[model samples]
Target: MSLHEILFIVFSTVVLLFSLMTVLSRRILRSATYLLLVLVATAGIYLWLQYEFMAAVQVALYAGGIVVIIVFSILLTHHIHHRSKPFPPVRVITGLGVAGLGAALTIWAILQHDFHYHEAEPLEVNAKVIGQHLVNTGDGGYALPFEVISVLLLAVLVGAIVVAKKDKANEQTSENK
Candidate 1:
């Protein structure tokens, strides 16, 4: 096998394994760490595919930004070492069923696609074009999605703060009582 194939296998394996660990881990911090690993592995795959800008975005946005926020939220909860309760059998079964269905659908879609490999010149990377595409309101622009993601992150931050504050208030009230 070629080196590219070997690297792809390794990176894909890391992504899959860490993703499974993220879902199955009992400790909240451990789960977050596993998710970070998964994101980093996904970035590696993007890099391998020669999408340097996409790989950087994956690393910077998802891995660096989101994962850091998640870790901070977990730390703010003061439950760094807390373990989540084990999933019930029914929940486990349902999760597995849904995952299997998604995987089957994805495989079927891939099989239906015509991915004829062609050796073409790489597209030139231009910062100005990329920036315009990111913020443009015209066709093929990503402005809407970017705004949505920003809003989602804001919501997560607000929710984390509310939860942390509520927990502290409950603790103080119980102590006074």
Candidate 2:
């Protein structure tokens, strides 16, 4: 096998293994750590595909930003070594069934699609062009989606803070009583 194929296999394996680990882990903190590994592996795949910008964003936004936020939330709300309750047999079976169905559908779709490769000149990509596109509101621009996501993230942060404060308030009231 070629070096590219080897690296792809390695990255894919890491991503799949860590993704499974992330879901199956009983400890919230461990799950978050596994998710971080999965994200980093995904970034490796992006780097292998020559999408440097995408790889950086995956590492920075997902592995760095999102995972840190998740870890912090977990630390703030739960004990560090807390473990999740075991899944009931019925729930486990249902989850497996759904996962099987999804996998089957994905494989079927892949089989039905025809992909063709074409040789094309590589386009120049840089931070300046990316910045312009992000701010542009015209055709093919991502300004609207970017702003929407920013608003959504802000809302989520506000909601989290409110919930945390409410919980503390309730705890204080109970203590006083």
**Which candidate has the top score in TM-score?**
1
> lDDT score, residue 111, model 2?
96
Off-target runs (Cα >4 Å) in candidate 1 are: 124-131, 140-142
Q: Tell me, what's the RMSD of every candidate?
A: 2.1, 2.5
- Tens-place lDDT digits, model 1, residues 13-100: 9999998898888999999999999999999999999978678878988899888888888888798989899989999999999999
- Measured against the true structure, the TM-scores of the candidates, in listed sequence, are 0.87, 0.85
lDDT of each: 0.89, 0.85
Candidate 1 minimal-lDDT segment of 10 residues? 122-131
Q: Extract clashing residue pairs from model 2.
A: none
TM-score of 1: 0.87
Which residue segments of model 2 deviate by more than 4 Å? Answer: 124-131, 138-140, 166-177
